[model samples]
Target: MRMFDVCIIGGGPAGLKAAIAAGSQGLSVVLMDDADHLGGQLVKQTHMFFGSEQQRAGARGVNIAKELVEQVTSLVNVEVVLCTTALGLYDDLVLTYETEGSYRKLSAKKFIVATGASERMLTFPGNDLPGVYGAGAVQTLMNVYGVKPGNRVLMVGAGNIGLIVSYQLLQAGVEVIAIVEGGPSIGGYLVHASKVRRAGVPILTSHTIKEAVGVNCVEGAIVCELDSQWQPKSGTEQRIDADVICLAVGLSPLTDILWQAECEMVFVPELGGNVAYRDSTMCTSKPHIYVAGDVAGVEEASSAMVEGELAGLCAAKSLGVSGAHLTLQITSARSQLEELRSGPVGDKIRAGLLQAHR
Candidate 1:
């Protein structure tokens, strides 16, 4: 088994940044991602990011992923492994992964689990139908594979993912029948909702899918208005024609490995789901184990990257790695993360973080 100073799992923005940070400190680092590509959900994000200049604001997510991959690959001390899956966490910080039909084991002094999050699926009639797809799946199909998800679609969430994917569908020449949200108010940014609305897609608040009507696949959908208690009201059901039913209900962190490793976990619905409990430095309950990105909690990719930088720098510093600017780098990263998590948009996240601290 080859030993490394840091083994970063899931080569998305967080893992890639962590590898670069640790490697820059002259630490031996190994970065692994399951996909043939390095970026997690970043590859499918075609929209410009929102943040300050340091967060690569205005840059497309695809471009940011490309830049991060290039930076990590150029670092001599970091080994990049694509098409690799980190299967399990074992005693002594050992990780096992499968690649090229062979299982490999490696041990590291520290680990950064940035496994990201999985899209939540809605339970409803005909949900498992062929034409029913997760919002992220639709994005991957259209953005990454260049394949149209469907010609006519009904979006079943008003969150950021649903709104953005609806707009992207329109850009792809797909017709969006309507966006149905269970909440009284739209969950995503008003700007995004406005963009979709200007394009003629109706944003129906306090509405939800009664059923994805179909036999072999989704051929249409039945939506109904919700009462104050969130139950579908009687006599308000409307049927619409749509070939695709895209569900963007929410997401949950991918923290099974953290559970296997016995890291302290907390359930934060705002952060998506159960995530590893980490301190300000992003260190989890396990001293040598750290977490960032969606695995820490389902925040944006920019914040995930900043969190990765904090973890990587702190991990290096904890290992007695000396650098004149180490302290400053860590401070700046933490500040940037705080700034990103500020504003009314981050109120839930702030509440979640506070709950975790408690």
Candidate 2:
């Protein structure tokens, strides 16, 4: 069994920040992730981010993850375990995970769970077809592996993932016929929606995909308009020929490890599936364990990193590594995090925060 002052799980924007923050504070930290490499989903992202300059605004997620990895790897107190998936958390905060071909146990004096969210997928009649895939998968194939998911695609969901991916598909020389959104308005920001809109792809509102029409692979997408109650309207169905179908409805946190840890949690749909309600320190109902990033709730990479920094700082403090400095750092981080979680869009998520403490 390996031991550390803190174990930060998940190596995306959140876990990477936690590891860096804790190491900077003189805490021995371990970052465990499932991928063969670092960056997590950020590895699959090629576009720049949008936010205040402090959040690395306009920097590609790839560049941001590069800088983050560079910082963490240079720290003597921080260690990274790649190609490892944390399976469960046991008593004394023992982290059970598999790495390479072996299972290992790691114990931490304090723990920060920063495992991020996974892309949420929708199943249609032909969802099982070969060409039907999640936007994240498309990103993985195209952005990370440099392999095109398809030549022509029909995107379902005009949300950020869908729109941004449609634009990416265009960047990769693939054609996007149209994007469909079930909501009245495009599900993502107009900035992103308009980017693709100007490129000549139509954003269809109040629309739903009835099926991906094909026998083995998606040959086309069959779409229909929805009524006020989201029921399919009669005679509005249409088919747009395509070779691929991308689903980008949204994301939900991967919280199975939290479940195994038996952490007190709540299902707040707006926050993006099950999340632990934490105070400013990001500590969960289990005081020794803290939750941050999308696992705490879905927001954006900009805020998730700040939350992870705070969570790591707080966890180090709890375990007596500069516990006194925690207040100052936490104060600064919380202010920034609130900024990211504020605004009109943030307000909707703020109201969805589960206030019932366990």
lDDT tens readout by residue for model 2, 247-279: 999999888877887888788888888887677
Error of 2 at 176 (Å): 0.5
- TM-score of candidate 2 versus the correct structure, residues matched by position: 0.97
Cand. 1 Cα-lDDT: 0.90
Could you tell me how far off, in angstroms, the CA of residue 57 lies in candidate 2 after the best superposition? 0.9
Residue 164 CA displacement from its true place in model 1, Å: 0.6
Clashing pairs in 1: none
Candidate 1, residues 1-358, lDDT tens digits: the string is: 9999999998888988899889999999999988888888989899999989998999999999999999998999999889998988876889999999999899999999989999888888889899999998899899999999989999999999999999999999999999999999999989999999999999999999999898899999999999999999999999999999999998899998999899988888878889888887788888888998888888888898888888899889878986679989998998898899899988888888886652
The segments of candidate 2 whose C-alpha lies over 4 angstroms from its true place after superposition are 323-326, 354-358
- The regions of model 1 sitting more than 4 angstroms off are none
Evaluate all candidate structures by whole-model CA lDDT and list the values in order.
0.90, 0.86
lDDT of 2 at 92: 77
Best by TM-score: 1
